[model samples]
Target: MVKSRSETRAHILETAARLLDDEGAAALTIRAVAQAAGLQAPALYRFFEDKDALLDAVAEHVFTTYVTGKAAARDGDPVADLRAGWDAHIGFGVANAALFGLLVTPGRTSPVAEAGLVVLRARVHRIAEAGRLRVPERLAAELVHAAGTGAVLTLLARRPEDRDPGLAEAMFEAVLARILTDAPTPTDTSPDLSKLTVAERALLAEWLDRD
Candidate 1:
């Protein structure tokens, strides 16, 4: 049976992604992908404008799978959700070092990278809505992205046995300390004494009584 055009395109992307994962970015040429997908190089160009476009599609396809799993893992706690996202990002980067490097390489804007940023921003927005974010949502997201990416790259640079196991968690804690409030907004009417000064406590009690 003849495959539909969309199916053919998806097959090409899948083949390319497998090749990328198995052989790294250096092996992702139009000739190589076309050969793997059982298509002529010129025929492959019908779906992708060039080799770079094909690589972008492959990256997007792989990244979508990663992000879908991360989204499914989200629970109600915004802070926990953000932490899970960080762990997911680092895990993906470490496991797919070549793909991650390709996605983050200068001068190339992969949809995969953008999708990851969107997830990060959404997670940060949740914290902002909960009043747990001390920094502006955009800035907070940027900070987290910077730190997470740096941690992943730093870890990837070292030999597996030599890499610091706690590096990612430590970097995350440092970034979290900068972005999150000391405490989330109190749901109950009672004041949190530890977070308030004696004078502030009196003011809060008076305000609570007036409510």
Candidate 2:
């Protein structure tokens, strides 16, 4: 009864991610992961050379997943793309609350950090280009990302009884609106708002006018 290499690796990664979400990164020790995965400590070494390797793998997975989903949301219209992206970000953050917090928290850094930032910047460019985002798109993206990330982190930080689901969703929607309206965009060139159909422009204008 021998597990294939891929199977062993998958089990270890899944077990490690779950432990990280449940108990913070501290619970991802080799022994704990091994016990949780029903494998011995020595068996863990076959998948991950050490805890650093495992943590890096976890960070990479989280980063890649978030970036990929966000990039895919940048479809046709910038406004629609951004709106969809905002929803996706909120959903992912809420669903993977602990892991999302862990990956974004201030103090921790892993091998995935640099690569993640690079990918994030590229995604920002896509949204900025489509939306004709004003200010500086990169700066705007950073701010929007920070606010969105912060909201999710704070929500998860609260006690279970204190959590307010509706309030959180509303807050995200409100912040997203603000970010779209006021965040940096390409101001040097005149925006092609006319590219929108009459009905589309009217709807956009109405949305822009809302408080």
Candidate 3:
């Protein structure tokens, strides 16, 4: 059966991603991808010009998924939110080390990667607005970005069994020490509304914010 353009493109990306995972990025040649995806080599050019272009698309496709889900989930506490983002970033990087390596290559640029940064910056900005962030918002964001990326790369470089289990969290705490103010951030003193439905809790928060 013939597939829609998008469906066909998605199939190619999935097949390429599987190849990348199984055999590394070096195995993602257009011919290899075309064969694995069950399409003629020439048919791939309609979706991607060459191996590099295809790799770029695959990185965006994969990172876009990680960034989307990361952005959707949140911790009410700004500090915890930042930590959660750090954890998620590290997890994604280590899990998809091959694609993550492509992502952080010098001079590489990606909208999905930028979106992840946007989410991190927004989380930092929240702390700054609350007077709990010691550093400038941009600097704080950069610090977190650099440190998180570095932590992931470092862990990826190590043998899985040899990796320090606490390394990522330690890096996060170090960045936090530099960025967060001495004054403790406020706790969620708001009454527990666990009994309320999700929609009801959202409505209540919306009402509270309006006051």
Candidate 4:
């Protein structure tokens, strides 16, 4: 039975995504995908020109879903916007750890990466503009993503017996608060070291003495 072009494309993407989620992105291959989809290896060529093309399609699918959901969750306030985005971003990573891992890992360039960067820049710029941050919006977005990913990695690395969902959520919230609040304000005056306690001064001196 001959399948329609859309059906074939959908099957390929579904198969690829499953492979990505179940076995990591490195396991993705035309032959494996075709076998998973119950199609001959040549049939995959009709949907994707090569393995990179197939991977691009899967990345696009995952990223589009992510970006769209994030966009929908945005509210007008910049602080609130940042909070919501961080929460959703971390939540996605926790829920879809394999897919999230695949998306962020260094790999071939694709439109999926481009699309994610575009949306993230826009969101980060909106927040940075509100705060008059000196760093570029893209840099801010990259930092935010890196921090969130680090937290997710910590959560994922926990042993199954030691994993506590509530504790992880609380820790994520704590980290987000520190990131948003402790970040320097461009025009804010630097605090005087003279005002610190003796212990604080010693700690500061120790830090300053570090290479």
- List per-prediction Cα lDDT, in the order shown: 0.89, 0.71, 0.87, 0.72
Q: Rank the candidates by lDDT, best first.
A: 1, 3, 4, 2
94-126: candidate 3 lDDT, tens digit per residue: 989888887788897766677778888899988
TM-score of 3: 0.80
TM-score of each: 0.80, 0.67, 0.80, 0.69
Q: Model 1, residue 120: displacement in angstroms?
A: 1.0
- Candidate 3: RMSD to truth: 11.8
Which pairs of residues collide in candidate 4? none
lDDT of 1: 0.89
Please write out the lDDT profile of model 2 over residues 55-172, one tens digit for every residue.
8787677656666765663466555555565566666777776667666768877666556456556656776666555447667667667776777777777876797777556765
Off by over 4 Å in 4: 65-73, 132-138, 164-211
| Best by the lDDT measure | 1
Pairs in clash, predicted candidate 1: none
Q: Candidate 3 or 4, higher lDDT?
A: 3
Clashes of each: 0, 7, 0, 0
lDDT tens per residue, model 4, 145-183: 667777788878887577766754575465445445445
Q: Which stretches of candidate 2 lie over 4 Å from their true place?
A: 59-74, 111-119, 166-211
Model 3 stretches astray by more than 4 angstroms: 49-52, 65-72, 184-211
